[model samples]
Target chain A: MAALQSIKQNCKKVMCIGRNYADHVKELNNQRPKQPFFFLKPPSSILLPDEGPVLRPAGVNMHFEVELGLVIGKQVKDIKAEKDEDALQYIDSYLLTIDMTGRNVQEEAKKRGLPWSIAKGYDTFCPIAGPIAKSKITDMHNVEIYLKVNGETKQEDNTELMLFRIPRQLSDISQVMTLEPGDVVLTGTPKGVGPVTSGDVMEAGMRINGKEVEEAHIKVE
Target chain B: MAALQSIKQNCKKVMCIGRNYADHVKELNNQRPKQPFFFLKPPSSILLPDEGPVLRPAGVNMHFEVELGLVIGKQVKDIKAEKDEDALQYIDSYLLTIDMTGRNVQEEAKKRGLPWSIAKGYDTFCPIAGPIAKSKITDMHNVEIYLKVNGETKQEDNTELMLFRIPRQLSDISQVMTLEPGDVVLTGTPKGVGPVTSGDVMEAGMRINGKEVEEAHIKVE
Candidate 1:
């Protein structure tokens, strides 16, 4: 698959999910939110897609979350559920994402009910996998997230268990706003989330149709 | 004062506040939210620390939101309200922020419970003004936001009227995610919001102690 135009070589917005899964929310002591919460990470936060080393942040407790990332090929917005075909009009494209979290920071942010920008929006916080064709995937609604730290499985989940499904979120998010080309979406992360530290090599990848959409190894800097 | 190290020259995140003001909430037909609603604008959304026109994307209905911005000086987490003063121990400085919005996208995202990165995070969407001292500002709790478009006054409010307040938000946001230097906190816009079109010019600035901190002019692109 060719690289999506916007993310091919332009600025990308890393749109990510928070508390989209019930158990993850419970683990964090957060009540299931009425709405699916989202946050942003700067494009620079990304590791070059398909590259390795996971690039962990040193001196602090950091965690890993592997997610099914969807990159819009074209701008998508205000999509009606009935406009499934029309909704495709707004998809920028598809991609993979590693929504790394500062668990310590996340806990504090949730407690304050403050916007999680400061805690989540770091230069290397949002990492991408590849530009996959949305049509190539059979089940956009159901997908698995696999994360391993130093060859140990830490987090693994599927999209079906998400508190809010993708199409619904796409329509809901787009209605109030526009989803542009190269804009990435973090569908959500599953259970078994854990922490990583410096010198700890971690690999996270997502497989769809027996292909890896995301493959990354994080190393502490 | 010498420029504080707070402004990360390469800022990755622009965290924002929505309906932070009571009257502003009323203007939007919203009751004051129990929690302070926030969103993310990518670094591409930023203009500069000084005055400049926030570029308006073609064909979208965009609006102006005058806000105060803070530049965190260090990596901080678990900042509690009581320890906010300690949180200040890490902040390098603050600036004034103009949170430009794509009204349509924001509302749509809010309704669908999707993230607002797009509506808020477009290139050059976040305009900053007045570089001030982190140690200089007497109170992040109560600063003033004065805004105008094409020479017409649009919004005027004091941070004192904010429901969540600064230290509280700082503590809360820092706890959820780590805040690094140059990451900004846009305290949210006040009321009297409206749209601007191509060829419309926006001029905004802020003041502390009767001195201008920073200001900028934005023209639709």
Candidate 2:
């Protein structure tokens, strides 16, 4: 893994998995999906670490869920995911990202069977950090993901707790939507999700064996 | 536009409107939304004019939705749409496109309150044609849109019937998701949308005053 390019320039779509962690599903009172469930965030919503603050829409409850972001390295479709290694080859790098949500809007959309684009796609909503190559982490399933707001830990979880792991998610998603190089996949968030108001600062990161591999600092305004 | 580049290279995301026509709403038994409703289609699903074919997944009921595609000329956000004129400046070109959907998958997702990504994000799901410059169409709202499957008309309607016109859709959508250069906004489809299977050839296009301005020839396989 050498120096990587900026995601803002290379990425196309942000394919995201939802409810991959059972506890997070329980926390949201959402039914655990039988198969891998997913949604998408537009590339327009991608905000680099130094781009600017994430604007909290007026009259909307904004929340943050930190997760590991996989950068697809090649064009792949219908990948067989009998083993994690099969899907791992397609990932060239990773990032730490915050999937900011309009919680109030999302709740209404969910209840009314509406698409979540508006709820999940405000400008600067997705703040990203690190394209740490896949080689940085020896085991994809053994890393720790954490997020803090105003220096208070709100979310901390291990990837091992994921209900539908990366391999299955990639394989299932690729079967329907072709995974192209430069495309990103946000592996679902963990439990302990909460809201963040204006003037709040969020610090999210990924760690391997207690060593911080990547982190993102974001502000809400 | 002077012979525009391929959409697969220039496009970032396909922001689409849903239930924008009264007749289409009645046919689907969906309530007319008070505001503009939108969803996203990844750039990966974009199939250019010379691109091969639209592949229908096994056991999926695929339906064709012909629409007027607006190509954003420049980056715009929070566009005011008290009138369509206020938003028309953002559009540089237009396209005739079909929003292929997995009707069965969508119906189930709608029933379970799930996201519609899988139902709408399949490869070759978005087939497009024509970058006919904005100058070609005298009135955006007065254009005629129609689609035929195997030479039989399945959908036919006029943009004048749109519940929420383009300007309003763009203005409302830009308020949430920033529209960028090359990003496309597919105005919702009309009534008489039916199933398209393997070996069906879909010819969809837009017209003004009964004269064809643009057309798309898509083969399903």
Candidate 3:
């Protein structure tokens, strides 16, 4: 498969799942949610590999969560659980991405029962590596996703750890909002999420069939 | 100025302010936020007048919020309050828009400290009328924004009631997220917000200089 081109212009929204891993939920000291919870990031927040350094908002403790990304190839709405397999046809490609968050600000918003836009929607808050066609991965469940900061492994997990897998997650989200072509869905990250600061070098990647399929190098500014 | 053309394709994101009006805060029984809080909707959620009827999700209570929409004409980031006047140059046009929401879903999400994307981002959730050039209004603060359900006025308020005016709101938002050309800012809704059912007709408009500068007629499915 050829390398995936930048989908910034085609991408309309970045939908993300929250607390999809039991370890991640326990690490954050958060109760298990009854259902798959989702949030959004504007297209402007997408930082491609060649887009330069990621801007770290001054004085804010920003954290990073690495996850697998699914790019929709067709429009879908009101997808049903029974037809989850059919929904997979709509996914054109997959990539490795990061969900950057402002920890203190998000905590404050949660305490006040406010929205999470300011905490999660900052510029350069989302970064993605080159994409691989969906056909490249023979077994989605066996893929390994990991991240390293400053040459030290920070997060290491597999897709089998996700609480809500791709099919169910996509179906649940489509029931609320239509999934259009180029829209990216970030399946929740696993445990070991931590904060990043200025001048940090981060590497995230996905391994399929014992080979690196997708990877991204991000420099914090 | 000619009737404002539909900006659905040009709009990158629909950014909204919450609890910006004192009366609205009292009506919802929400405390006045010390700082402006915001949420987002995808550009795909935008439904133009010519696009047809607004689809109401079954089993969910839907509500309408009329607001003045600012269409960004230039890119801006980290704008300061002192430079707010200059920020106005980036706003090329204004229009009337409805922030359709799933109230029940939103309330539930808020209680659980979850994101509000599902509640506020259903397809056809944002209905926008044609655009009115910014120069058409002599004083943005004095413009009247109102909504009528089936020809009966439900909400009537002036922009002067907003807690954070355009300049300050823009400055504050740009500090966190980059405001790109064609992006929109919904300055928040006034009091008299209520739910609407299928088969209802919604009329929302903005009165500038005692004249209806922009208005939209939406039919609920």
Candidate 4:
């Protein structure tokens, strides 16, 4: 197996999609958003493959949602949705990554109308795979993403099911903040998200045209 | 006047306090939070003092919030509240910064139980002055913070009014995410935050023991 490429040191931010998959939205009982909703995780939250175990915070219900990660290749700001094709030119690569969440804490925050920082921004909460060049995936809308916990498949879906596609997401986000080189965007997650416990081994992977493009593994501590 | 030192390049993450001042909370008609509420802005959002005209996004009601900024000098993780005094040791400097916000967007997000990224993470939304060594201020808890728009005083208060002081905020945040060198923490704003229109000149400053310590100005474009 090849060594996993870490985006930790160079990554400036982790922009995440919230409730982008229809099934996942239904499962979580969340309203379908009119526009793409996003939150952020600090670069310090990134846990590289070489890093040993993913620490599960005590007394919190930690859940895992695997999503496709896009690495921005150039600077982008105030990009219009109609010019999404030009915005696509800013993407450099893709990979599989986990958006770890403290589900219970998030629910509490939502109830109180507070920001979701502590629920989604803990250290080692984001685990990513080695990068696969953007050219490797010819169809951005049809790739498959999956996650398995303790060898049991939990989440499996195709990018075709996303409520908001990559181009629109990038364009919309660029309109808000500039996307610089090495900044990451997690393109939402599918259904079947569930809890993970200490001593569990998790695997997340991506496939294009039925060919495995990238995968990563991490053990819970 | 000396040239303003820029932390924009080296800054990793910006952790912000929400509703930390009682007067500000009342001014916004928000309930007092039992614990500190935080949101994040990307490093790319940072605009240095000398960086000319702060661009105002069209169709958004942009607001200015002046707060005390803390620059972490050492690594911190999983620190306890009782050890907050030790956590303060990691802070090397302070500055006055604008936590620029999109008021309408944030209200909409709060109503939908969504994150405040787009509301608080827009490019050039965070304008910071050059850092002041922590040693310069004899009393961190009693420093004065003030902001002016078009030469009219808008916000004025002392750090003594903050519900969650610097040590508690830093210690609480470290328990979730590691505070690395160059990471900044905006310790919430005081009352009198309001809108900024094009052509407006905004100035924010801080004083310790009635002596001006740091101040910076930017024109709204």
Model 2: runs farther than 4 Å from truth?
A1-5, A214-221, B2-5, B214-221
Q: List candidate 1 segments past 4 Å from native.
A: A1-39, A42-221, B1-8, B49-52, B209-221
* Model 1: per-residue Cα lDDT at residue A94: 61
Docking class of predicted structure 3: medium
B1-221 in candidate 4: lDDT tens per residue?
12335466667899998999999999999999988878899998888865677777888898999998888888878666544356568877776789999999989888878888888998889988857766677677788888888889999899899898777888788888998888889999999999997788887887777777734333344
Give interface RMSD, per candidate: 5.8, 0.9, 1.0, 0.7
Q: After superposition, how far is residue A171 of candidate 4 from its true place, in Å?
A: 0.3
Best TM-score among the predictions, by candidate number:
2
State the C-alpha lDDT per candidate: 0.64, 0.84, 0.82, 0.83
Q: Look at candidate 4 and give me any clashing residue pairs.
A: none
Provide the lDDT at A82 for model 4. Answer: 45
TM-score of each: 0.59, 0.96, 0.94, 0.94
User: DockQ ranking from best to worst?
Assistant: 2, 4, 3, 1
Model 3, chain B only, scores a TM-score of: 0.93
Deviation of model 3 at A176, angstroms: 1.6
Candidate 3 per-residue C-alpha lDDT over A1-221 given as tens digits, one digit per residue, 9 for 90 to 100 = 22435477777788999999999999999998778899998888888877777788887898999988888888888777544366568788877889999999899888877888888899989888867666777666677888888888999899889888888888888987888888889999999999888888888888876677634334444
Candidate 1 lDDT, B20-94, residue by residue in tens: 888888987866878665657765556664434555666567887878787766766667765447657766666
Error of 3 at B145 (Å): 0.7
lDDT of 2 at B31: 94
> Looking at model 3 chain A, which ten-residue stretch has the lowest summed lDDT?
A212-221
Worst 10-residue lDDT window, candidate 3 chain B: B212-221
